[model samples]
Target: MSRSPKINTVNEAATKYQAAPNEEYQLVEQAHRGVPAGAFFDILGFSGLTKEELSGLLDVSFKTIQRYQNDGKKLNALNSEQLLKMITLYQKAEDVFGDLVSFNRWLRKPAIGLGNQHPLKYMQTPGGIDLIMDELRRIEFGALA
Candidate 1:
Protein backbone atom coordinates (compact mmCIF):
# COMPACT_ATOMS: atom_id res chain seq x y z
CA MET A 1 0.00 0.00 0.00
CA SER A 2 1.24 3.44 -0.87
CA ARG A 3 1.28 6.07 1.81
CA SER A 4 -0.19 9.49 1.16
CA PRO A 5 1.99 12.57 1.28
CA LYS A 6 2.17 14.10 4.72
CA ILE A 7 1.74 17.86 4.61
CA ASN A 8 4.40 18.48 7.21
CA THR A 9 5.14 21.77 8.93
CA VAL A 10 8.63 23.28 8.93
CA ASN A 11 9.31 22.22 12.52
CA GLU A 12 7.96 18.77 11.83
CA ALA A 13 10.32 18.34 8.91
CA ALA A 14 13.25 19.55 10.97
CA THR A 15 12.46 17.29 13.86
CA LYS A 16 11.91 14.28 11.69
CA TYR A 17 15.30 14.71 10.05
CA GLN A 18 17.00 15.52 13.33
CA ALA A 19 15.98 12.35 15.10
CA ALA A 20 18.63 10.47 17.07
CA PRO A 21 19.70 7.12 15.68
CA ASN A 22 18.47 5.14 18.67
CA GLU A 23 15.25 6.99 19.24
CA GLU A 24 11.94 6.48 17.52
CA TYR A 25 11.03 9.46 15.39
CA GLN A 26 7.84 11.25 16.23
CA LEU A 27 5.96 13.73 14.14
CA VAL A 28 4.59 16.82 15.79
CA GLU A 29 0.86 16.64 16.28
CA GLN A 30 0.39 20.36 15.71
CA ALA A 31 2.42 23.26 14.27
CA HIS A 32 1.31 25.96 16.69
CA ARG A 33 4.31 27.82 18.13
CA GLY A 34 6.65 25.18 16.71
CA VAL A 35 8.15 27.07 13.78
CA PRO A 36 9.95 30.38 14.02
CA ALA A 37 8.52 33.24 11.97
CA GLY A 38 11.95 33.80 10.49
CA ALA A 39 11.98 30.27 9.07
CA PHE A 40 10.96 31.91 5.79
CA PHE A 41 14.58 32.88 5.36
CA ASP A 42 15.51 29.20 5.09
CA ILE A 43 12.90 28.73 2.40
CA LEU A 44 14.11 31.85 0.65
CA GLY A 45 17.67 30.54 0.59
CA PHE A 46 16.61 27.14 -0.77
CA SER A 47 14.42 28.78 -3.42
CA GLY A 48 16.82 31.64 -4.23
CA LEU A 49 13.95 34.05 -3.68
CA THR A 50 13.90 37.54 -2.27
CA LYS A 51 12.08 38.56 0.86
CA GLU A 52 10.23 41.25 -1.04
CA GLU A 53 9.03 38.74 -3.64
CA LEU A 54 7.87 36.30 -0.99
CA SER A 55 6.13 39.07 0.94
CA GLY A 56 4.40 40.11 -2.24
CA LEU A 57 3.48 36.53 -3.13
CA LEU A 58 2.04 35.91 0.31
CA ASP A 59 0.35 39.36 0.33
CA VAL A 60 2.17 40.42 3.49
CA SER A 61 3.63 43.85 4.20
CA PHE A 62 7.38 44.43 4.36
CA LYS A 63 7.29 46.14 7.73
CA THR A 64 5.15 43.43 9.24
CA ILE A 65 7.50 40.80 7.89
CA GLN A 66 10.44 42.69 9.32
CA ARG A 67 8.77 42.65 12.69
CA TYR A 68 8.40 38.91 12.51
CA GLN A 69 12.09 38.60 11.77
CA ASN A 70 13.17 41.10 14.40
CA ASP A 71 10.99 39.78 17.17
CA GLY A 72 11.64 36.12 16.29
CA LYS A 73 7.94 35.46 16.58
CA LYS A 74 6.38 32.19 15.52
CA LEU A 75 4.52 32.18 12.26
CA ASN A 76 0.77 31.87 12.51
CA ALA A 77 -0.90 28.72 11.24
CA LEU A 78 -1.75 30.03 7.79
CA ASN A 79 1.66 31.54 7.11
CA SER A 80 3.36 28.40 8.38
CA GLU A 81 1.27 26.27 6.08
CA GLN A 82 2.17 28.45 3.10
CA LEU A 83 5.84 28.37 3.97
CA LEU A 84 5.79 24.59 4.29
CA LYS A 85 4.07 24.21 0.96
CA MET A 86 6.61 26.45 -0.78
CA ILE A 87 9.50 24.49 0.67
CA THR A 88 7.93 21.22 -0.38
CA LEU A 89 7.46 22.51 -3.91
CA TYR A 90 11.05 23.70 -4.08
CA GLN A 91 12.33 20.33 -2.94
CA LYS A 92 10.23 18.54 -5.52
CA ALA A 93 11.42 20.90 -8.22
CA GLU A 94 15.02 20.25 -7.28
CA ASP A 95 14.47 16.51 -7.41
CA VAL A 96 12.92 16.71 -10.87
CA PHE A 97 15.14 19.37 -12.49
CA GLY A 98 18.47 18.40 -10.84
CA ASP A 99 19.33 21.91 -9.58
CA LEU A 100 17.80 25.03 -8.09
CA VAL A 101 18.88 27.22 -11.00
CA SER A 102 17.21 25.00 -13.58
CA PHE A 103 14.05 24.70 -11.49
CA ASN A 104 13.98 28.45 -10.90
CA ARG A 105 14.35 29.08 -14.59
CA TRP A 106 11.53 26.71 -15.38
CA LEU A 107 9.34 28.37 -12.77
CA ARG A 108 9.73 31.74 -14.46
CA LYS A 109 8.76 30.60 -17.94
CA PRO A 110 5.31 29.84 -19.33
CA ALA A 111 4.67 26.11 -19.15
CA ILE A 112 2.65 24.62 -21.98
CA GLY A 113 0.75 22.32 -19.66
CA LEU A 114 0.00 25.24 -17.37
CA GLY A 115 -1.88 27.09 -20.10
CA ASN A 116 1.21 29.16 -20.81
CA GLN A 117 1.24 30.61 -17.31
CA HIS A 118 4.55 31.19 -15.57
CA PRO A 119 4.69 28.65 -12.74
CA LEU A 120 6.20 31.18 -10.36
CA LYS A 121 3.04 33.27 -10.48
CA TYR A 122 1.00 30.28 -9.39
CA MET A 123 2.92 29.85 -6.11
CA GLN A 124 0.46 32.15 -4.36
CA THR A 125 -2.50 29.76 -4.32
CA PRO A 126 -2.96 26.13 -3.26
CA GLY A 127 -4.91 25.28 -6.42
CA GLY A 128 -2.22 26.81 -8.57
CA ILE A 129 0.37 24.81 -6.63
CA ASP A 130 -1.52 21.63 -7.36
CA LEU A 131 -1.58 22.48 -11.04
CA ILE A 132 2.15 23.10 -11.12
CA MET A 133 2.81 19.85 -9.25
CA ASP A 134 0.62 18.00 -11.72
CA GLU A 135 2.61 19.47 -14.55
CA LEU A 136 5.83 18.36 -12.87
CA ARG A 137 4.43 14.85 -12.62
CA ARG A 138 3.58 14.93 -16.30
CA ILE A 139 7.11 16.00 -17.08
CA GLU A 140 8.50 13.14 -14.99
CA PHE A 141 6.29 10.62 -16.77
CA GLY A 142 7.46 11.80 -20.20
CA ALA A 143 4.15 13.41 -20.99
CA LEU A 144 5.55 16.77 -22.04
CA ALA A 145 3.00 19.21 -23.39
Candidate 2:
Protein backbone atom coordinates (compact mmCIF):
# COMPACT_ATOMS: atom_id res chain seq x y z
CA MET A 1 0.00 0.00 0.00
CA SER A 2 1.16 3.55 -0.78
CA ARG A 3 1.59 6.06 2.00
CA SER A 4 -0.42 9.29 1.86
CA PRO A 5 1.20 12.64 1.02
CA LYS A 6 1.69 15.05 3.87
CA ILE A 7 -1.02 17.68 4.16
CA ASN A 8 0.26 20.83 5.82
CA THR A 9 -1.73 23.20 7.97
CA VAL A 10 -1.27 26.94 7.42
CA ASN A 11 0.63 27.34 10.66
CA GLU A 12 2.86 24.43 9.74
CA ALA A 13 3.57 25.83 6.27
CA ALA A 14 4.21 29.31 7.65
CA THR A 15 6.52 28.03 10.35
CA LYS A 16 8.40 25.83 7.91
CA TYR A 17 8.95 28.67 5.46
CA GLN A 18 9.69 31.31 8.10
CA ALA A 19 7.48 33.71 6.15
CA ALA A 20 7.43 37.23 7.54
CA PRO A 21 4.27 38.02 9.50
CA ASN A 22 2.79 39.99 6.63
CA GLU A 23 0.27 40.10 3.77
CA GLU A 24 1.88 37.34 1.68
CA TYR A 25 1.33 34.60 4.23
CA GLN A 26 -2.04 36.11 5.12
CA LEU A 27 -3.25 35.65 1.53
CA VAL A 28 -2.11 32.04 1.35
CA GLU A 29 -3.39 31.32 4.85
CA GLN A 30 -6.81 32.72 3.98
CA ALA A 31 -7.04 30.70 0.78
CA HIS A 32 -5.79 27.41 2.14
CA ARG A 33 -7.13 27.69 5.66
CA GLY A 34 -9.23 24.67 6.67
CA VAL A 35 -9.14 23.39 3.09
CA PRO A 36 -8.58 19.81 2.05
CA ALA A 37 -6.96 18.43 -1.10
CA GLY A 38 -10.31 18.21 -2.88
CA ALA A 39 -10.99 21.88 -2.18
CA PHE A 40 -7.56 22.75 -3.50
CA PHE A 41 -8.25 20.92 -6.76
CA ASP A 42 -11.68 22.58 -7.03
CA ILE A 43 -10.21 26.06 -6.64
CA LEU A 44 -7.59 25.39 -9.32
CA GLY A 45 -10.28 24.00 -11.61
CA PHE A 46 -12.44 27.07 -11.05
CA SER A 47 -9.65 29.27 -12.37
CA GLY A 48 -9.88 27.40 -15.72
CA LEU A 49 -6.14 27.00 -15.66
CA THR A 50 -4.38 23.70 -16.09
CA LYS A 51 -0.97 22.98 -14.58
CA GLU A 52 0.59 23.21 -18.06
CA GLU A 53 -1.16 26.52 -18.73
CA LEU A 54 0.08 27.97 -15.46
CA SER A 55 3.60 26.77 -16.16
CA GLY A 56 3.66 28.53 -19.51
CA LEU A 57 2.05 31.69 -18.08
CA LEU A 58 4.54 31.81 -15.22
CA ASP A 59 7.54 31.23 -17.57
CA VAL A 60 8.85 28.71 -15.10
CA SER A 61 9.66 25.08 -15.68
CA PHE A 62 6.82 22.70 -14.89
CA LYS A 63 9.07 21.19 -12.23
CA THR A 64 9.44 24.60 -10.58
CA ILE A 65 5.67 25.02 -10.56
CA GLN A 66 5.26 21.58 -9.06
CA ARG A 67 7.85 22.44 -6.45
CA TYR A 68 5.73 25.42 -5.45
CA GLN A 69 2.54 23.34 -5.24
CA ASN A 70 3.95 20.22 -3.63
CA ASP A 71 6.96 21.52 -1.75
CA GLY A 72 5.43 24.80 -0.54
CA LYS A 73 8.01 27.09 -2.16
CA LYS A 74 7.18 30.72 -1.47
CA LEU A 75 6.99 32.85 -4.62
CA ASN A 76 7.43 36.32 -3.17
CA ALA A 77 8.11 38.18 -6.42
CA LEU A 78 6.91 37.85 -10.00
CA ASN A 79 9.29 36.49 -12.60
CA SER A 80 9.37 38.07 -16.06
CA GLU A 81 6.52 36.00 -17.49
CA GLN A 82 4.45 36.47 -14.32
CA LEU A 83 5.13 40.20 -14.39
CA LEU A 84 3.90 40.44 -17.98
CA LYS A 85 0.75 38.52 -17.08
CA MET A 86 0.21 40.76 -14.04
CA ILE A 87 0.50 43.91 -16.19
CA THR A 88 -2.13 42.60 -18.58
CA LEU A 89 -4.37 41.44 -15.74
CA TYR A 90 -4.04 44.78 -13.97
CA GLN A 91 -5.02 46.64 -17.15
CA LYS A 92 -8.19 44.55 -17.55
CA ALA A 93 -9.00 44.76 -13.83
CA GLU A 94 -8.62 48.55 -13.87
CA ASP A 95 -11.10 48.88 -16.75
CA VAL A 96 -13.75 46.92 -14.83
CA PHE A 97 -12.89 48.57 -11.48
CA GLY A 98 -13.18 52.12 -12.87
CA ASP A 99 -10.54 54.58 -14.02
CA LEU A 100 -7.32 54.57 -11.99
CA VAL A 101 -6.85 58.27 -12.78
CA SER A 102 -5.22 59.18 -9.51
CA PHE A 103 -2.69 56.38 -9.95
CA ASN A 104 -1.74 57.52 -13.48
CA ARG A 105 -1.55 61.14 -12.34
CA TRP A 106 1.48 60.34 -10.23
CA LEU A 107 3.34 58.87 -13.23
CA ARG A 108 2.59 61.94 -15.36
CA LYS A 109 3.87 64.41 -12.76
CA PRO A 110 7.32 65.87 -13.63
CA ALA A 111 10.08 64.31 -11.60
CA ILE A 112 11.79 66.77 -9.30
CA GLY A 113 15.55 67.31 -8.97
CA LEU A 114 18.70 66.20 -10.80
CA GLY A 115 21.95 64.46 -9.75
CA ASN A 116 22.25 62.22 -6.68
CA GLN A 117 19.36 63.89 -4.84
CA HIS A 118 16.85 62.93 -7.56
CA PRO A 119 14.78 59.76 -7.57
CA LEU A 120 16.42 58.84 -10.89
CA LYS A 121 19.83 59.50 -9.40
CA TYR A 122 20.83 55.92 -10.01
CA MET A 123 20.66 56.63 -13.74
CA GLN A 124 23.12 59.48 -13.32
CA THR A 125 26.84 58.75 -13.41
CA PRO A 126 29.65 59.98 -11.14
CA GLY A 127 32.40 59.27 -13.61
CA GLY A 128 32.23 60.94 -17.05
CA ILE A 129 28.81 62.47 -16.27
CA ASP A 130 28.88 64.66 -19.39
CA LEU A 131 29.72 61.68 -21.61
CA ILE A 132 26.93 59.60 -20.06
CA MET A 133 24.44 62.46 -20.49
CA ASP A 134 25.45 62.82 -24.13
CA GLU A 135 25.00 59.10 -24.74
CA LEU A 136 21.58 59.10 -23.01
CA ARG A 137 20.40 62.13 -24.99
CA ARG A 138 21.55 60.48 -28.19
CA ILE A 139 19.68 57.30 -27.35
CA GLU A 140 16.53 59.18 -26.30
CA PHE A 141 16.25 61.84 -29.08
CA GLY A 142 18.57 60.39 -31.73
CA ALA A 143 18.95 57.08 -33.53
CA LEU A 144 22.55 56.78 -32.36
CA ALA A 145 22.13 53.47 -30.56
Candidate 3:
Protein backbone atom coordinates (compact mmCIF):
# COMPACT_ATOMS: atom_id res chain seq x y z
CA MET A 1 0.00 0.00 0.00
CA SER A 2 1.23 3.48 -0.75
CA ARG A 3 1.24 6.18 1.90
CA SER A 4 0.85 9.91 1.55
CA PRO A 5 3.53 12.29 2.66
CA LYS A 6 3.00 13.82 6.06
CA ILE A 7 1.80 17.40 5.84
CA ASN A 8 3.86 20.06 7.57
CA THR A 9 1.62 22.81 8.84
CA VAL A 10 2.93 26.22 9.90
CA ASN A 11 2.69 25.41 13.60
CA GLU A 12 4.29 22.04 12.98
CA ALA A 13 7.03 23.69 10.96
CA ALA A 14 7.69 26.10 13.79
CA THR A 15 7.81 23.35 16.37
CA LYS A 16 9.72 20.88 14.24
CA TYR A 17 12.35 23.42 13.15
CA GLN A 18 12.47 25.32 16.44
CA ALA A 19 11.78 28.33 14.31
CA ALA A 20 10.19 30.18 17.14
CA PRO A 21 8.54 29.45 20.48
CA ASN A 22 4.95 29.70 19.39
CA GLU A 23 5.05 30.99 15.91
CA GLU A 24 4.49 34.56 14.76
CA TYR A 25 2.10 35.61 17.49
CA GLN A 26 4.75 35.24 20.17
CA LEU A 27 7.52 36.89 18.19
CA VAL A 28 7.80 39.99 20.31
CA GLU A 29 8.66 37.91 23.35
CA GLN A 30 10.84 35.56 21.38
CA ALA A 31 12.64 38.48 19.76
CA HIS A 32 13.41 39.98 23.15
CA ARG A 33 14.50 36.59 24.42
CA GLY A 34 16.58 36.04 21.26
CA VAL A 35 17.02 32.97 19.08
CA PRO A 36 19.83 30.47 19.55
CA ALA A 37 22.52 30.21 16.90
CA GLY A 38 21.79 26.52 16.44
CA ALA A 39 18.32 27.34 15.16
CA PHE A 40 19.94 28.71 11.99
CA PHE A 41 21.69 25.42 11.43
CA ASP A 42 18.31 23.72 11.56
CA ILE A 43 16.65 26.38 9.43
CA LEU A 44 19.35 26.82 6.81
CA GLY A 45 20.43 23.20 6.62
CA PHE A 46 17.01 22.06 5.51
CA SER A 47 16.61 25.03 3.19
CA GLY A 48 20.00 24.44 1.53
CA LEU A 49 21.07 27.99 2.30
CA THR A 50 24.66 28.70 3.27
CA LYS A 51 26.06 30.82 6.07
CA GLU A 52 26.83 33.44 3.43
CA GLU A 53 23.11 33.80 2.82
CA LEU A 54 22.37 33.84 6.51
CA SER A 55 25.00 36.52 7.15
CA GLY A 56 23.63 38.70 4.37
CA LEU A 57 20.08 38.24 5.59
CA LEU A 58 21.05 39.15 9.12
CA ASP A 59 23.46 41.94 8.17
CA VAL A 60 26.32 40.24 9.98
CA SER A 61 29.65 38.89 8.91
CA PHE A 62 30.03 35.21 8.10
CA LYS A 63 32.65 34.85 10.84
CA THR A 64 30.33 36.38 13.39
CA ILE A 65 27.58 33.91 12.53
CA GLN A 66 30.11 31.12 12.84
CA ARG A 67 31.25 32.48 16.19
CA TYR A 68 27.69 32.48 17.45
CA GLN A 69 27.27 28.90 16.33
CA ASN A 70 30.53 27.87 18.00
CA ASP A 71 29.66 29.69 21.21
CA GLY A 72 25.97 28.70 21.35
CA LYS A 73 25.17 32.38 21.82
CA LYS A 74 21.74 33.89 21.34
CA LEU A 75 21.25 36.10 18.30
CA ASN A 76 20.95 39.81 18.95
CA ALA A 77 17.58 41.56 18.71
CA LEU A 78 18.12 42.60 15.08
CA ASN A 79 19.08 39.11 13.94
CA SER A 80 16.36 37.54 16.06
CA GLU A 81 13.76 39.67 14.33
CA GLN A 82 15.09 38.80 10.90
CA LEU A 83 15.28 35.11 11.75
CA LEU A 84 11.64 35.09 12.82
CA LYS A 85 10.64 36.73 9.60
CA MET A 86 12.61 34.16 7.67
CA ILE A 87 10.93 31.31 9.49
CA THR A 88 7.53 32.78 8.78
CA LEU A 89 8.34 33.24 5.14
CA TYR A 90 9.69 29.70 4.77
CA GLN A 91 6.71 28.17 6.49
CA LYS A 92 4.36 30.02 4.18
CA ALA A 93 6.37 28.98 1.18
CA GLU A 94 6.22 25.37 2.26
CA ASP A 95 2.48 25.67 2.60
CA VAL A 96 2.08 27.27 -0.80
CA PHE A 97 4.32 24.79 -2.63
CA GLY A 98 3.01 21.83 -0.60
CA ASP A 99 6.58 20.64 0.04
CA LEU A 100 9.96 21.92 1.15
CA VAL A 101 11.86 20.78 -1.92
CA SER A 102 9.58 22.59 -4.35
CA PHE A 103 9.74 25.78 -2.30
CA ASN A 104 13.55 25.64 -2.15
CA ARG A 105 13.70 25.12 -5.89
CA TRP A 106 11.38 28.04 -6.48
CA LEU A 107 13.52 30.21 -4.24
CA ARG A 108 16.52 29.51 -6.46
CA LYS A 109 14.68 30.32 -9.69
CA PRO A 110 14.13 33.62 -11.48
CA ALA A 111 10.54 34.81 -11.14
CA ILE A 112 8.62 37.05 -13.49
CA GLY A 113 6.79 38.68 -10.58
CA LEU A 114 10.17 39.38 -9.07
CA GLY A 115 11.25 41.11 -12.31
CA ASN A 116 13.02 37.97 -13.51
CA GLN A 117 15.46 38.20 -10.61
CA HIS A 118 16.66 35.14 -8.78
CA PRO A 119 14.58 35.19 -5.61
CA LEU A 120 17.59 34.49 -3.43
CA LYS A 121 19.35 37.59 -4.68
CA TYR A 122 16.65 39.76 -3.14
CA MET A 123 15.75 37.49 -0.22
CA GLN A 124 18.65 38.71 1.89
CA THR A 125 16.71 41.67 3.25
CA PRO A 126 13.38 42.39 5.01
CA GLY A 127 11.70 44.05 2.02
CA GLY A 128 12.67 41.11 -0.11
CA ILE A 129 10.99 38.75 2.32
CA ASP A 130 7.80 40.77 2.11
CA LEU A 131 7.97 40.77 -1.66
CA ILE A 132 8.41 37.01 -1.77
CA MET A 133 5.53 36.51 0.63
CA ASP A 134 3.32 38.63 -1.59
CA GLU A 135 4.29 36.51 -4.56
CA LEU A 136 3.57 33.37 -2.60
CA ARG A 137 0.15 34.72 -1.71
CA ARG A 138 -0.49 35.46 -5.33
CA ILE A 139 0.57 31.96 -6.29
CA GLU A 140 -1.58 30.42 -3.60
CA PHE A 141 -4.54 32.28 -5.00
CA GLY A 142 -3.88 31.08 -8.55
CA ALA A 143 -2.68 34.41 -9.89
CA LEU A 144 -0.38 34.56 -12.91
CA ALA A 145 3.31 34.86 -12.16
Q: Which one wins on lDDT?
A: 3
TM-scores of the candidates in the order shown:
0.74, 0.27, 0.75
Query: What are the clashing pairs of model 3?
Result: none
Error of 3 at 84 (Å): 1.2
Best by TM-score: 3
Please report, as a residue range, the 10-residue window in candidate 1 with the lowest summed lDDT: 20-29
Clashing pairs in 2: none
Which prediction has more favorable TM-score, 1 or 3?
3
lDDT of 3 by residue, 1-145 (tens): 2222332345544664356523555775676788777666556655667777777777788778768778778898767766777778887887799877888789888999999998777776756877888989899999986
- The models' CA-based lDDT, in order, is 0.63, 0.33, 0.72
Which is the better candidate, 1 or 2, if ranked by lDDT?
1
Give the alpha carbon lDDT tens digit for every residue of 114-134 in model 1. Answer: 899899898886457667878
Which stretches in model 1 have alpha-carbon errors above 4 Å?
1-34
Order of quality (TM-score): 3, 1, 2
CA lDDT for candidate 3: 0.72
Q: Could you tell me which 10 consecutive residues in candidate 2 have the lowest summed lDDT?
A: 118-127
What is the total number of backbone clashes in candidate 1?
Answer: 0
Angstrom error at residue 94, model 2: 14
